[model samples]
Target: MKRIVEFMKRNYKIILVVTALSAILWSFIPREKKEDPEKDKLILELLTMVLERGHYSPVEINDDFSKKVYHKYLENIDPTKRFFIQSDINEFSKYETSLDEMILRKDISFFNLTNSRLLQRMKESRKIYENLLSKPFDYNVKESINIDYDNLPFAKNKSDLVERWRKQLKLSTLSSLTDKQKLEEEKKKENASYEEKSFEVIEKEVRESTLKSLDEYFNFLEKELTRDDWFAIFLNSIVERFDPHTFYFSPEDKEKFDVSMSGTFQGIGARLQKKEAGVEISELISGGPAWRGKELEAGDLILKVGQGKEEPIDIAGMRLDDVVKKIKGPKGTEVRLTVKKVDGTIKVISIIRDEVETEETFAKSSVVEKDGKKYGIIYLPKFYISFENKENRDAFKDVAAEIEKLKAQNIDGLIMDLRDNGGGSLETVVKMVGLFIPEGPVVQVKAPRRNPEILPDPDKRVQYDGPLVVMINNFSASASEIFAAAIQDYKRGIVVGSKHSYGKGTVQNVIDLNQFIRSSSFGDLGALKTTIQKFYRINGGSTQREGVKSDVVFPDRFSYLDMGERDEESALPWDKIEPAKYEPLQINYDNIILNSNKRIATNTTFKLIDENAKWIFERKDEKVISLNLNDFNNELAVADEKLKKFKAISDYKNTYEFKSLPDELALFEKDTVLKQKRERWHEEMQKDIYIEETLNIISDIKLLTKGKSLTQKLSLN
Candidate 1:
């Protein structure tokens, strides 16, 4: 989920100010060193101090909290219960209730013990997997393995662990064998003379592939991760006991988070994925320096990275983040990359780093026609902003620009799609709500022992006054919820989508942990993102656990699943305050909602989606899987047979043709990559039954508005 952050303002300084910490901890400071345990201790002390003083509602650091952190840290490190055995757990269990004391005293004995033991266990696991994959499995063996890891106990001994590893590998290989056999049969059906590989040959090939994957997985663990990474996981377990959104971002992770929030970074602009061979380019951002150079292509393995005139360092086995750090630098600086192309050719490509904007993160609009009238859909991926530069491109400015473009097209209605928009800047959301309604209170923010601060749009200008719709889904969160809740409270627009948006109402502020320390000898102390406040709707309701429910609900595949902020154990409870004084827009959507629901009840695609949702809920906990080839194939055949009834859901398509706005058409001539992306989006939109129903709702609203206006004209006559 994206963070909804409130930047450091004057008032917030009072709560976070820890001026006395420097004087108190001065004697405990250590000398300058590359890696220091003393630095870790200092960070822990600083984090707890800030959390206790500045967090909106901090949980007490008692034994109960210690037990939660203990289990959570262990579960996060070894989620599948493959690395640690019962003996390791027994050894670690002794300190489960004492972690709170350790934190209080800045002692890391528990963390150090677990970290070393995990490393040892991981080393032993490599040999176990290697030995198991060296031989073939007997598919004739009739056995089943429970895939549920949470309830499964740790192995009793080393031998039991090895047996556990064997069964897991055997299950994987057996599934692959059955799939290969089926594909061979399909090839024979397509061409009777086609030569198929032997069953034993395919089995060996699958085993080799599985072995390579394991090698890469272990290689990442050994080469990429460090002690600090594990320590960050442990730190997060401590902070998250306060709430789910509170977290500790390592220096490397903090940089990444900044890039995500801004959606612009100075870099090569190519996404990389680590594989067994090396780091491979997944996609080159359109209009980026690498894309402009036209030399580096996706699937090319980056072998080395060099800055300016320095000698290139081999990155064959280096961590991906470190490799990225070497490649990305200040704008106009030269970086050379040695890459192996997909055709097995080696090339050295030098490119200048520039500010690359991720286009997908911004707002874009599409125009579609229905019932002889045009409607505009503006898709906002997040409420992003550059906290460092005010003039930089942001969600509010881009969306306002899109609205003007749609106005130029003379569209009758608008749809603001916030599906999967986790959220971003809180300030941006307040301004974005101004685009739809007149100047009014947008949302309410409350901190611990502070009066409610009512944020409003004071421009007194409405950018779009026509029929409007705000679309959301289960994944839409924080700032998205604020926008929807405001619109719903004002009765300015119809909120439509899954039951409600993601319920994340709290606000986080990332504090630079190094600011409180006077010593540069300890290096960067990373950052702490703690929840310092909770936001409420203009109508006095908070969207903490109960998110902004849609005015018109649509059945979705995830309808019955437990998700969103409500599912988080440490999520803040829902509450309310006095409502902000504001007048609701004079628009009634009762008929509009009623009409949409009537149509949804008869829609066959929606009915099938409801059935699919029910089917998914029924099998949500079907964890026991067959390890035998015959039984596995039988189970797959039965599932496939049952899933045939739902195939029409994928085949369902609408007749509406979505197209890019007038401005994007001219740019598409030089930027074919962007054109291809828009074409794919349009294709997906055409098949979206939810969008089709949304268009119908907009049509109903338009008709209602027209009728109301005509009555007013008659009265004037």
Candidate 2:
């Protein structure tokens, strides 16, 4: 994502040497007829080789690293400590420190042992849950369950494990039972004649529902997941030890990664969810072929999928990912689906697969009027780009187009909202930052043993020059940090929202592992995403651990909670490099920040928000919950009462009205779905206190700029 070009350009020789070595070795290795352990060994060998040679800063794969990987893998498989007992741990603990040696020798004995034991334990637990849920729980008894699974030890024996499972299940049912009771009470309040079910009847229903969900979950694990899937998990536990960003993507996962980054794929564009009956249509992407066809609808169960003129394969009891693979194909291909419609009719629906764009993934702008001035707000969900095709839609081009449209409407100021944006293509972000500034360094990336390379906006044309505000939150990461850092460094705009953005400055490149082997009987070898570079701001400060600190910080629920890159144990260290040469703009932010802070300090809504944030921070460590029905109900009542004051947070709205651009308004006549999405966005913005504050800040900046201009003219005269 960050260093694709640089990696290929600089590491061609290293890649060639490894490819030759892997080809020679793979040629001699015996191919197994039964199991795929040979492929696993090859993956381990290649991953270590590439990571050691090509990673930004690879860690020593010694005993310490081995211990971390061992525990992490176990935690991944049995996180709740319910499946594996103390005896299993004792058996697996022998390889805790020797995993490094085992990995180097291409021996997967540890993985083999753990995987088999876990499967057996999972099979046994199924019976325990079924037996426990069969009888009515004594809700009158006082008991508590702690959800801090990491701190809990493995059960000593089978009896202890069953007791642990009982408490967990009881807690879950108790929660559901209370919710159902409240729902029935509300229904009775609405209509006195409404027939309310008895407590026993509701309790039985909750148990049945829980059992169904657990059965479906176990069914998926038993049917869908293969040895390769578990091996992928083990591989990730190894690779992530190098850094949090480094990952091993299985063949199926690699495809998903590509789809996520590009936000476009060739498919019927119906979201599917796995259910006991079959794969259900969760939703249809607007403007997609399936939605346009009108034959497919949400809640329809897909029975089978077929290619053009081919025999359909029944998708009953198939994995959701597998079902999706069968339905999706290259653009302009015909795929027929045998579906059971919501109306209880079974029919075959023919759909031509086409490129479907997830509208929510792209940037959209809304124009809002505040204090008689129109300002534009552009929300970018991610810096998306179609890596396979440049001609396809990208965030940079779309944002630029939106800027032009907003300018045509004669907007006074601009706000770029990057909250909850996890970031995407690095090139897209560089071009996006170029839209605001006139030719300057956007970010400085440094690879291992290499000088920092400045990525600058070569374009001298400035798309928007007036007062600008960039909004960010704790979830805003990588490319988002790069954009915010550049904007802050240039003094070109005000950064607002959370205390700081998500600290994820490292760049990754997905290396196709199949490229290393010339030929293989072992099918697709998948890919690896490894950290290759860490980027810094134009001001020489790295956003690795210390993310871009906002010029004006807002109170949030996670304000005091540890999160982001800093919270990750394997995150790359933050460092500073020599600053790139750039001129900072002369704008007076002192008065603006002071004024905003004064307003926030006294505003009742802000005060309440700050208080709510503290309240949330206090409850962050509350992991234990009462399983007794009366006690659980009391706990929920106390929480509800405490949260009643914070309800105003959602109800709060500004006096300004938000409107869509004229172009979108015209398009809305035909695209009702897009219109509805925009309406929801605009409605949310109307109630957003942060947006209101940003608009006020923009107004202040505009007023300050005008006053300075008049002062300079008078002085010259």
Question: Candidates' TM-scores?
Answer: 0.85, 0.85
Local distance difference test, each candidate? 0.82, 0.81
List, residue by residue over 393-496, the lDDT tens digit for candidate 1: 89999999999999999889989999867788888999999988767899999988888999998677878877788899887888999999988888777999
| Model 2, span 431-538: residue lDDT tens | 888888877789887878878888889787888877789999877888889899998888888999999988988877778888776677788889988888888899
For all candidates, what are the clash counts? 0, 0
True-vs-predicted CA distance for residue 546, candidate 2, Å: 1.4
Report the Cα lDDT for residue 35, model 2.
52
Candidate 1 C-alpha error for residue 169, in Å: 1.4
Best by the lDDT measure = 1
lDDT of 2 at 581: 96
